[model samples]
Target: MLQNNSELKSKIDQLWNKFWSGGISNPLTAIEQITYLLFMKRLDELDQKRKADAEWTGENYTSKFEGQWIPPEYRNQSEPEKFAIDKRTLRWSEFKRMQAEEMLQHVQGKVFPFLKDLNGAESNFTHHMKNAVFIIPKAALLVEAVKTIDDIFAVMEKDSQEKGQAFQDIQGDVYEFLLSEIATAGKNGQFRTPRHIIKLMADLVQPQLGHRIADPACGTGGFLLGAYQYIITELAKKAGAKDLAPDEDGFIRTSVAASLTEKAQAILQQSLYGYDIDATMVRLGLMNLMMHGIDEPNIDYQDTLSKSYSEESAYDVVLANPPFTGSIDKGDINEALQLSTTKTELLFVENIYRLLKKGGTACVIVPQGVLFSSGKAFKDLRQILVERCDLKAIITLPSGVFKPYAGVSTAILLFTKVWGAKDKITKPATENVWFYEMVADGYSLDDKRNKQQGYGDLQDIINQYHARDAATDTDRTAKYFMVPRSEIADEKNNFDLSLSRYKTDVFEEVHYDAPDVILDRLIQAEVGNLDEAELAKLQSGIVRDLLDLKGMLG
Candidate 1:
């Protein structure tokens, strides 16, 4: 379906309303309380399906699938029919009376053995849920909320693959919920990276449908999801007939929207890859991928900052918006990605640069000031890039790009591997660089950022980037300028990635009164009031008297 901004926003709001209607408002809290519900629902649904399948073959299926011992509890009150339902209310009071710790220990011992590898589950959630604090102000409200979500999931589960408008609607809602959680994460630089930024970077690189993409700093996996979207849309176009409308985008079966579970599953391992240090964020990122229809996500909770990968792991493309502040703890930074600089952003920049192959491309976000800061640390890094890599573009975004959000004046730097551009028989290989001042990335990002308004208008940018010629002296100060490899290679190699360093702003004029106008105003204000006239006369007399004396000239 065609979607305008208004349409997308409306759909997102629709999903939020659906969530409230289904009652899972506290996403942070719901997972802990809803685990028991999910377990019961799965138990009932799985056992019944197994029994049906087995009876068709005249075999005993109940004992084989549900477990060695069906929990005595399952026999009392059956699975809640929906993801929105609370598992606590039962016709089974005795089961509810089982102590929280004791029940989980017993369940973990006997029940979990059968339900291995459920989607969106982490082993930790199961291990901790029994003893996890379920401290919502009102336990009953929590119960009601869980029941509502139960109903919602039940409807969703009618078809295993998520697809169509409802799938889009539901997943869009989930995206915002995930963003909200990150927003509240606050100051830790766990703040949300605007999706448009990801989309814009995607446009800049236009990753081929089959290429691999990774975000080593994958916060909430925003970059990974963007890469997934790019691939999915492109893949659909490839599979579709030349003149016909698009084919089933992952096979739709519902009035609601969802990801094609199998399509997403296949893509998860092959296409999208990410890692983050924050365990909380890793969970949310996985859920974000799953809720958006990705099954068996590739996201992991390990700190990418502390790990290294082989040359085989080099990606065809890498996109990252590394956190702006904080230094990597001394002994913890991953050797592959770590830089000589203790500052985390600088370390990540060098890390991302190193991770790409001889010709791999990267689009990374950085603080505007990093481009020209004459520090000893960044200077050499800049030198390495200019001397070795093909440094292509710099985009300076406005200070308010983060507005009402967080104000971090930033820029995007583009680079590609040099391959044998170095050690070639020809002249120095990496030469011209393009610089563009996004002024705005086509969006307000203002609690209201718009794509059309800022650099979000990417078609022109992409075109200019391709048509861009070799570095030149004159174009260096133009709005969208070019700098020669020689200019960049100069002794300083300022590699200051800031766009403003190269692109000249169109300095606008302001009206100014002429000098006569200023003099007339001064005379009108100070001229012959009796006191002013007398003072002027006294001053004139003193000058005349002084001038008449030889001593005055001497």
Candidate 2:
């Protein structure tokens, strides 16, 4: 829906520029401030919707806004003073009607504290909200932002109704578009993966309900959210719902709450998890999942590749695009990772492998260097994947996939852990590894990343992966093919997983005119106005030059 909503995009742009001009120049900070405002507005909207539903169905539902306020300063005061101020005034609906200055004071003084105390003192939201500050700085900017957000939501509501889309889907799109703005600003080493690529990875993994899905270096929780949406869509299909329709961006938006039973929804909420080193990213990731109906998102602020994290073999499915350009402190590296390297990319890959339970699958993106680097650390890691696990597929992505932020070529590695009994080393279970060369991902490979119709290979890659046949499908020249493990283990290849190493070029031959015939044609074309004697002289001179050149060569 965001693809077709020009007005919405304009409004968001206006809001972003307002923040920039209003002295909030940092993109992440600006986005956080906007997120807090949007959350406030959405909280009131959701409460009202629930109240109406409860009234219609005669169900008992308590609204979070239906309470009284006793400020910490007045808690020990007289009863009259303690009960004097109504907590309802802190609600967005009530305060939005007040004067701009009054609204700002009320939100900064009361509403933010109220949010920090939501769910309980132990809730993740409250824990993260403890450090949240309202930095809008002026009543006028806050008012303008609130108005623009209202208009944005209005457009989203209309689009959702017309397209049968979940409102959360539209909200997620709005958040993603905002994040893409961050990518466009040239924030090095910190960029959200495109949604279509996330969806493709989710489909390849095929996550199901009750499966613990995690992203160790989740940026805004895109991959985990994709897996959540995929599971919900599959549940809908199984329940006989209509086909999930694709939006203009080619993403299928489905209402998980409407399609899934309460139990299934609970399982889904508990199954999704994420971690990020940046506290701001953790907060945004939490808000991202919570806005999508995951009541309690399990996202935390922790460097997952550090020694402090000990959650090995705890997740059933691991999906991540971890930071690929940094190295960790040698003292901070986890002892559990046997790979000898501080490269975050290689260490994160090993960490992902360690985090998976036996038989658990993982789909991760890494730099192209990880596939075929001749370094001992790189080759050792590749051997661990090829010999110790069921290394499934190697998908080489274009260098421009993360363009404008990083042009480092990347690839997706799909494998499953297979630990032997008694901790003995196990033989490689991989007979053949599927390889896919993704030339286009539905978008141009430039900084603009404009969508190109009928050019993306995502769906075709997914299809060929599922229908892959090792015995009969032996064309190495095709985009999709398989290579045997024995060939991968050959000393000459050094277990190189790059597709180009195994792919063979098919040469086509062409015929050309003889040199004498070509020279005769050229002479005829140039000697049209020359006399016979002149033409003969020209031919004799050409022959004499040719003879001299041939003698010199000899």
Candidate 3:
């Protein structure tokens, strides 16, 4: 969505430059700091709107800024009331009116502390905010940032009204744009999954309302947010709302406000959960969900692969693009994960399998190597998917799908747990496995990833996957086909799930002259057997080419 709006894109670029020029060079740190400012602004605006709503309905409403608040650091003073400041003064709307120096001091000394404690001690956002620091170094820089953010919001509001897009969605896109500036990869091969790819996985998984959804290595909660948006869009369609439109990636989209009923709001508060080893990611992810109207996101700072994480078989839907880090410390590996290898890609897939409840579904992205590797662990993982679970589909993505961050060929695994069986397969659940080789993903395959004219195979993948028929989709020569489990599980195949293993390539037929005829033609040319007129024409052509070259050089 932000891609189509050059104005918004420019504004985001300007904001990024402001942060960089204003002493914040690290992309992650700059984004986190920017998130805090946005939250502060959004908090005040939302509170004001709620107040107006309460007054309109003649209801009792308590605003977050309704009373005086004491900074936690000053609470132990003998005369604590002397240190108290009016909560109203700490709001973005109020502080933004101050002089640059005063505003900087107010935000650093008073407003940030208030925001950190805004959700109270029990909230996960607050838990993650404990170590967060207000690090904008100068007053002029703070003033410029606030002005740029205001301009951005104004443009977002205008875009929302003019284009019938959601303001919240645009705001979310702004954050996503900010995140795209983090050019460097994180520890353990972690990087943000492209939002469109996440949307594709969400559609295949079809996370339902009230279904506990999770991402074990959710960097910035893209998968969880994708599922949430999908659920909201589905709800809007069910409600018969007519404002729904397809996003840039061709997925149906609607304003969260369209179907955000009280029940959905309540159910959503508990539905999406995520974990990441990076605390910064956890914080940014929580804020990301909150920015999109999820009041209390469950992203936290814990490595799911660690032995300490004990929640197994707890989620109903798992959508993840776990880091492709090759290996993890063997000692830190979770015991419940039955995979014996320390290969992070394999172990995380197993961890996802364990995280799903009986009959639960998981859509995960893994490097293509995991599909056809000859290693025993790779074969064993594929065996569990085919024999113990209802292995649904394997979609091979082009290697360039992750360009600029990685060029590793990857595939999506869509499967469901069956009867909660473990260790041994009581019965083989997969009769056939669906495979699709996606050649393009609606963007140029280069590092820039410029948007192309049409979405290539994205809409087709969704439509075909939902309408896939095992009986009729048997053409091995087509882009999509079904492969029998027996073929995949055969000893010769070694449980290889690579799409190429079953796909048949059809080469076009060509006719050529017999070898003797071609050889005679070659000899005729080499031996100068042509007529005098033909030889004269060839000599003239060579002379003309030489003249042209000499003329160009001169």
Q: State each candidate's clash count.
A: 40, 0, 0
Question: Order the candidates by TM-score, highest first — what do you get?
Answer: 3, 2, 1
Instruction: List the candidate 3 regions with Cα displacement exceeding 4 Å.
Output: 57-59, 76-79, 419-424, 511-554
Cα lDDT tens digits, model 1, 1-554, are: 22233443443344444444556676554433343344444345434554785688686653333222333335455552322212222212223345555544434444343333332135432322223343334434434434444454444443224332344334443344436543354365545666656667876777765467888778677888777766565554555513222212212112111223445446445777787776556665665565454545667655556645443337779999887776877687665642467787677777777667777888998876678777766776676566667788877777667765677778888888664322443344467778876665555556654335223434456667777765442565565777777767666544555555555656689998865565455544544354766767854764334434424335
Output the lDDT of residue 314, model 2. 87
Clashes of 1: 40
TM-score, candidate 1, is 0.65
- List the global CA lDDT of all models: 0.56, 0.83, 0.86
TM-scores of the candidates in the order shown: 0.65, 0.89, 0.91
Top of the candidates by lDDT: 3
Better of 2 and 3 by lDDT: 3
Give the winner by TM-score: 1 or 3.
3
lDDT for model 3: 0.86
RMSD of each: 10.9, 5.2, 5.2
**lDDT for 76 (candidate 1):** 52
In angstroms, give how far residue 95 of model 2 lies from its true place.
2.0
Ranking by lDDT: 3, 2, 1
| Model 2 per-residue lDDT tens digits across residues 485-545 | 9999998897999999999899999998876666556555657688888877876786556
| Model 1, CA-based lDDT | 0.56
